[model samples]
Target: MGTIYRGGSRGALAGLRRPHLHPVPSVADRLNAERHELAGAACTAADPEVFFDGTQDATDVAKRICGGCPVRARCLWLALEHGEAFGIFGGLTADERRRLRRKGVSAA
Candidate 1:
């Protein structure tokens, strides 16, 4: 006669230290962190219009600020991942980056 048994606590604990135990943050979380950091820098404005300005040239100013930002990539990744339709992230005006992402998705 033979007996078969499923693994128990030991098996679970064995995998605890595996490299995959901690997963990388999703694009959204990274983006939020970057947003928080950017906000902490005190560049955030009380009015959205002050940042957006409703013109192509104005968007460049936003990008320039983002260029100097430490978390620009994370912010951009989040904006693209979450499909944010408004506000500035990583120094890009909402509309400006949205158009860029739209083109990327469409092209892909």
Candidate 2:
């Protein structure tokens, strides 16, 4: 068994155990970390056609790659928040994000 302490907070650590008090990263912070990792990769060998060929298939491939990512949701949230109009985020293609925004608007 471990002990948990509420950092920098008085009395917040009371009645808590260490193993149960884990820190969780915020979505924006996590996405920022992932962006750094994904941005430096070489996109040259990647099929430009797959992304730029003006086809849904290209977006599909992009989404597939995002799906495998661990920080997909965070990535998507950050992109949406920042009004990112391109690239794959949160396992969703640009088109998907557009649709999501549209849906949100319609719902409201």
Every candidate's CA RMSD: 15.7, 14.8
Candidate 1 backbone overlaps, count:
0
What C-alpha root-mean-square deviation, in Å, does candidate 1 show against the real structure? 15.7
Q: lDDT (0-100) at residue 41 of candidate 2?
A: 30
User: Which 10 consecutive positions of candidate 2 have the poorest summed lDDT?
Assistant: 10-19
lDDT per residue as tens, model 1, 11-108 = 21111122122232322232333344454433343223324354666566656666676666665665555555554665766667767876774211
Where does candidate 1 have its weakest 10-residue lDDT segment? 11-20
lDDT of 2 by residue, 1-108 (tens): 333334232221111112124332222232233355554333323443343233678777855666566655555666566555544556666677789998882211
CA displacement after TM-score superposition, residue 41 of candidate 1 (Å)? 5.8
Best by lDDT: 2
Local distance difference test, per candidate? 0.46, 0.47
Q: What is the TM-score of each candidate against the true structure?
A: 0.43, 0.46
